[model samples]
Target: MNMLRPACVLALMTLTACTQTWVDTKYQQSDRFATWVDSTPSPYRLLAGDDISVVLPFNVELNYKGRVAPDGTVAMPFAGNLPAAGQTLAQFGETVNRALAANHMTANAMAMVAVTQTAAHVFVGGEVGKPGELALTPGMSVMQAIITAQGLLDTARTGEIVLIRRSPDGRPMLRTVDVKALTQQGDPAQDIVLQSNDTIFVPKSSIAEVDLWVDQYINKALPFNKNVNYDINGARSF
Candidate 1:
């Protein structure tokens, strides 16, 4: 009948809208996120706790191992403590080479500064096997982060793993990733590069969750805050 035609058309429209929304959400978690991540800069900056191994290939005597001081400097044998916390590996290496050339310590010396240890912080929480702050490594990806957290649990929402990061302007931003799509579908684009202070949160499949727990675990402990909850993970020996 004529009345039935109108009802059928309305139902069809509703279904179409729902399908479009589902597609859009999936695209945001996949292709759209990939585009955004590809455009973001991922340069690694040296931090105070990071250990740098400087090797003067021509002058082995100048070779030394040291940590970047809290004052953003490194103590070399001849160079003393020079500024280093803000520079990248290449930039710091160039600065060291220039210093050697300027002081006439070693002419034609190419200084190489390598990060033997990175003290970069990355937090992993939610339905992971282990949830805690990890020491980040160069070239680490989101998938690797999950692995370092001891992999995911059976209750993990594989499609709802959220990455919390600070934007260029220092504002917090969130990106959802379909981890199953990355692992099962073999989509490398979903595997985004992680930066320091980044947090990966995997919510339960049945519930939508936020990162307040991550803040508690990180902020409520140690030098970050004074309220130390020694029972956060388990009973401690020390």
Candidate 2:
């Protein structure tokens, strides 16, 4: 037991050093992730499931509240289906006007589209007091998300917060942040702004090495394969 203890401590120290090296080279030195933190995102585009209010002055009957369908379209009273997702409010209004013209409903139809309820979302998990999906508000930061999660638990590792986000091009990426610097030292650089579909994971101090420790301790305990596993009855069930 005593010999095993020193091995564990040495392993932890070695892992910590490797993590610090990774944070410096892979994250800090990378320029691709800088855009997400440094640059402000473009205007919020309409998304599926967004509640929109459309007003048409010439055709009052056509004016109604509708939600964007899963296929990125909204059914208008006279215009049929119009693409609402991936467009700003102004762009959506233009689309409605063009649709109205194409249908010969009106020559100079004016449409005003406003997003009554947005569809953006952020996910918080791991050692937070509350871990779940949160509605992504305009200009929400990482710190705000932690607060919304009811703050970190006593066992949380503040310095090892991980932010997982998908780039605009649809590639998944990760960034490491030090919450201690952001909160205690007042470092704005450490507080990254959150985006839609962003996931913030605040790991516990004991599992700060993340997947490595999980693979060592947790994965080994589970007796299962990619194809089969035991059910609740403790029988080998497919």
Candidate 3:
């Protein structure tokens, strides 16, 4: 069996930030998201931040890839802009197929839509074995990402590993996770599902000023409690 993961490239840098709010993993659940581990992924609905690819077998020259716009649409060469968000890849594929036929490009067009990148990613940085942007597959956990990074370094502070996520309004929400206790005490709570654009920075030592470090060093942000509640007939906006 052959497996692949995104390469880890790192640079030692200080984690600086401004005043931030933290949701500790000890007492509460930070976010609510559906997991798609070993399940049919076709049901995964498209979101604004998701990146997709469209392939028109009948018109290969018109093939294109791009991110779903915030307005819930994706612009293609001939298709112009089609409703992409709130629709599954399969559903959107059919939409593209019809658009090609309507445009007289092909009467029997079978277009395929694939996700080149999901809306979220798991970024591991700081004192780790190999820290970089790790792919955030569906149902991926924090522990899994840490292991993929080849486990934490000895100099890494296990007690205060920082999990930085974005609020819906786009503000950074800092959280402290104790990986040491999670592994030593058989605690599952600490191994949270990595959210969209979540950054797990393993500090070499305790962070006296979390806000200052995050504001100064971190760039990517994520949201919490995100859910896609839509039915076959209609779609929901995120």
Candidate 4:
């Protein structure tokens, strides 16, 4: 009996070790991931849909709020037709200044152009506390965006938050952010600068309990002859 007890104990230890090894192997395989920059520069440029405030200190009466037309130009009284698209605020100001000077409207006109309204905005959708479109503001940050969205939902996969941005060449780029790390670990690097037309998506938690209910409903809907397995293991479930 003593020898049998020792053999049983040895077998149990072997089984435990094997189980641990399997778990470790699975974890190692799942660890294949990539890290990205915490903060990135805004890739958005002035487009046809943007609204700008053009101020001419030389003539406040001539100061106007201009919206970029479909053809990417704004109509100004003295400035005539000026191209406002594809230029930054500073660049646009320089252009307007040059135009006014050329037309002899103001010899030394000091103009300040700013983005008063942005028609290009970022959409925050899926599993966030509040899923909606957020308007882009000057000097907006990712942290401010999340806050505007009312923070992450309880089922939000903080590590899997995705930022989708479009490049100048019109190619879409994706960046994964660890929002929990930013909030919990106080990692400023994770607080990225936000741009117009960017989309921030917070995916639902992979550990959602509703998946089991969905699987059950699917099993019920399947025909009896379909040979569907009702067991969780049979469904290859998460």
Q: What is the C-alpha RMSD of each candidate to the true structure, in Å?
A: 18.2, 13.8, 19.1, 16.4
TM-score of each: 0.68, 0.58, 0.47, 0.66
Write candidate 4's Cα lDDT for 77-148 as tens digits.
788898888887888888888888889888766788878777666667666677667777777777788888
lDDT of 2 by residue, 128-228 (tens): 88877777766789999999989998777788787767666755466778999988999988888887777777766755556666676667866648467
Ranking of models by TM-score? 1, 4, 2, 3
Off by more than 4 A, model 3: 1-81, 85-116, 205-238
Best by TM-score: 1
Q: Give a tens-digit lDDT track for model 3, residues 1-238.
A: 0111222122113342211222234322444311212212236678776888888776788788899988888887777678988787789999888877787777766888888877656778766898877767666777898998999886677887777665556555566778988999978777877765677777764453454356545432433224655568886756
Check candidate 4 and list the clashing pairs: none
lDDT of 1 by residue, 89-207 (tens): 88988888877777779877688889988878777776788876778888788999999999998777788676756556655455677899998999887898888777677766543
Among all windows of 10 consecutive residues in model 2, the one with the lowest summed lDDT is: 1-10
Of the two candidates 1 and 2, the one with more favorable TM-score, higher being better, is 1
Output candidate 2 Cα RMSD: 13.8
Assess candidate 1 and give its TM-score to the true structure: 0.68
